[model samples]
Target chain A: MAQMKSANVRLEKLNKHYHRVVAVEDVSLAIEPGSMVALLGPSGCGKTTCLRMIAGLVQPSSGEIFINEQRVTRVPVHKRNIGMLFQNYALFPHMTVAENIAFGLDMRGVGKADAGKRVTGALDLVQLGKFSDRFPSQLSGGQQQRVALARALVIEPAMLLLDEPLGALDKGLRESMQVELRALQRRLGLTTVMVTHDQDEALTMADRIVVMRDGRLEQVGGATEIYQKPASRFVATFLGASNLFSGKIETRDGAGALVAVAEGFGLLVDGLSNEAREATVSVRPEAIVVEPLGNGAPRTEVPNSVVATIDQVVYRGFINHYYLKLPGGSEIIAYQQNRTSEGASSFAPGDKVIARWDASSNHVLPNG
Target chain B: MSGRLEGVGAWVLYCVTAAMMIFILAPLLVVMSVSVSDSYFVTFPPQGFTLSWYAKVLQDRDFLDALQLSAVLAFSTTMGSLLLGVPAAFALVRGSFLGQSFLKSLVLSPLVFPALVTGLALLQLLSSFGSGDARLNLLIGHIVVTAPYVVRTVVSSLQLMDINLEEAARTLGASRMKTFWRVTLPQIAPGVAAGSLFAFMVSFDNYPISMWLANSEYSPVPLVLMRQLVNVFDPSVPAMSTIIILLAVVGVLILERLVGLRRAVAI
Candidate 1:
């Protein structure tokens, strides 16, 4: 009934080691109060291990977790007062919806009358109030997720944790639940951390995304920022599709740098120096513009442009996918937006084209 | 037509099943009718129906003592087996340890072992330990035999249950013991109910084990019934057996009402 204050969660140099395998490595982060951050990574990347550690379900090899500036590294899971929704929803089969929602309060020694009122409030919050008397098995998958959401929210936890909360739903329901869960989280202003390998879910739901790789933090930024400015080759590829090129930096300036990939051909890429010469440069597929060869040098000065022959053309409704072969025996894909009435069939095979983009589109990663 | 042939086959199958059911139960019906016959000796299609044999068996002090002994033994055996077997089932189902399969085989071996062999083994094991208390002897023997059923049903139930339910309970702030009571125990109630009834029936009707473990002054109902048949020539033995069968059938019915008998046995 009352608005609960969200708490800040900070992980200080968190590390989890199982035998010799590192699950999470030197991970440090600060989650602002009421903000939702997603730990996004591929499977076995320790995204789940970090979430479990925060929930106090797993012991960290070496780390400290603080909630609202209180150290909780040694706190048991039950005393942590955190709510977690599992991937399977995991609602108790034998209990009714109201009982499942009120179990946390009941465990806290709350009075039965008070628990009933809050359970009713929680059921209405998830819009499952009428189904309070029904068992979990009687409800559909989406309804089960909503009831699980109610169960997690009724406790008014200090921090809410979700382990792929909507992964079990169908594609349509998963998209809708993602929106509903985000709205609920925002409305309650509950500081939340969700672990998900689906990049789309993280981008759609989290305020900030922390990408991980091989049990280490790859990059941490906002969804668009992470996509536009990936910190490494792995992050660039892991976040989305990319076309990478190896080049030698020819010149450097305060604004950007010039990188030469082939003979007499240099692309002026922004935001790089001499140190970036040895690193690989990534260009997003959608960012590349593919035009027919006879168009001449564009009326507008195009900075980072390359000469390539079209190998294959795929019509995918909204966009035309042109698989282009660069002169250096490398292949890069360009997704041309289908804006006119012609749609994606405008491009065909064996057409020589200049794939170009702005200098700012070049993403340089340091060589390891 | 093939459809007509299938119909004939189905009719034959139903007849065969019914015949098998009667084949198994016909002797019990004979004993029951003989127990109610007015004839002095055991006979079917009796001269007249009377309950005098029931009164005669009820009046027998040895019969009453044996009934009380059997009831106590059955209750204790079921309780002990559940206490020991449920946790063992959990460990076997959830625990990953060296020799896990071996331990499972060891616990379940009693199910396939002959009751006479188990009885002999228990007598030797207890006598080797130099114990003379026959009630304790019978209690231990019954637990050894009956616990496998509890273990089996519980393992079956646990196998069918989702493991995430327990983890979800823990995340919802339930402690280990609380999670077990609130989540784990209720999911497996059918299997437990089934197992307890099986244990009770097996312990109550056991004869060979009770024969070897009988105390100097008393024995179980089954053992007493056997002794009556061996020493006497009357309808009272059938009367006692008929009462035992009725009690067993009633117990099965009550368990089926409480937790569906199909669910318990399916495990």
Candidate 2:
């Protein structure tokens, strides 16, 4: 059902400075048509500033914005024809759901019959067909958000911008709405840009994730590329749980590079070239396997293995997280999934265990 | 023993509040009762109930003329105040300008200035203009007196509003002007209405400003009532005062119904 209206958005070296504070530094990004890109960062990391610049709510100190290859840097927000869903939903309290949805159409001088039809269709799209007569105060937060989405969509904007759309919802509601909104965006084929500080939301919903830090773009790539092959130490630590082992590269092999740990332990990481002689290697906790040392169990043919004492064991409902301390006093975490039939291993704190992982599982990130 | 003492203290407080209410309302009740009295002389208690004085006051051409003049003055003053006050409030609250604090203080200074002083100042200023138009002078004086209330109410309401709502509207394809009309104005409508009501009441019930500014040909209700009370011993004076009180009460009630009484007062 996707119509595939060209939604290519290009931002070229956008910059915004408030007095002496640089809100958004020099940043450039190209979003493909029909793609959902999430600008993910911590608070004040320039994600909202970028979204505002795209929406024309904020003027960039320098640079240009292009929609479908047409430069629209100087255009005002109203003329930009982009839909925005605010964090608060911002549904008009005085207006009923139908009137809220019909506002843009009314401003465009659409006739009563046509505007009403479009409002109904938009409300139905959000599955709020029976709530046309209810004011915003009567609706729940999720319902209000749906009404806001319908209002924006009724205008059939060129692009849709969601600024922390689900940030106000409860945990379960936020998860469900994320999936529902992603489905709607895909179904409508609307080029969408969403700003969020939630890493899980970005990973779950975005086709591409742009990681930002201190008003600069740290990395921009697919979810797997950002999570597995983060370009910098900041990206590695920000996107997910990773145990970073700081060291200098010792030797380069065809498969991976060998790195010298702080003390005596040596580590091997995949996809590192010889040129990367000084780098930080990151290993995800879920990638490491843990077993009792000298247990006589058949080991996988992974490149790097170390025997460490368990420093802490945190039993989560689905998995157990083990913090392992190596001989050199550096620590790494390993997760063991809990199966009812097999039961969890009795690995308590201070127990010694062998931690192992394939060389391919390790990622070498540039030092910030 | 402590709970008993607390209950006794609460009862004492309630009795004091009730006494205060009675003190405030007694004169108004007396005026209303005397308005309907059958006796020609002003008395604390009416011997008989009658609507003759009200009918006499309503039929009097002088009283009717004064009432019409007061209505016209009140309405024009309210309109004038809103025109000057809404923008001033907007600028003071939203615009970052040099000497903004001074500007805000200047806009609200009329509230601090005594009405008699303001009236005398306007009289001197109007006389210097040499137009000799009493109605014009009264309008200018009333505008000065009422505009501050409008500004204060509107600014308070604007401060309470969620500024993000307007930004959200702008992002939803609304231009700046459209955002003001569609989002900002609706949110502050209650405050504006309340401000206009206060402005009207101030202009209508004002004596010091109206007495100084009004000529023999044009007198507001309060000025005319004061003139009749001082010059003539008319029993219909209470009837006229009663009507003025009723009008004020009615205006407040209508305003409360339109917005909300609590919200209006708070703003």
Q: Candidate 2: what lDDT?
A: 0.87
lDDT by residue for model 2 over B113-166, one digit each (tens)?
899998988888889889588888899999999999999999999998988778
DockQ of 1: 0.43
* Per-model chain A TM: 0.94, 0.95
- Give the Cα-based TM-score of candidate 2 against the true structure: 0.92
Writing each residue's lDDT as its tens digit, candidate 1 over B1-267 gives 555546787899989999999999999999888888898788777658889899989999999999999999999999999999999999999888989989988898998989999999889999999989999999999999999999999999999888878777777788988988988988888889988998999899998788788875769998888888889868999899989999899988888887774343322
Q: What is the Cα-based lDDT of residue A163 in candidate 2?
A: 97
Per-residue accuracy of model 1 over A274-356 as CA lDDT, tens digit each:
34445468889998988777865633234478778899988888888889987777788888888777655655788778888
Which pairs clash in the backbone of model 1?
A: none
Candidate 1: Cα lDDT at B89: 96
Best by TM-score: 2
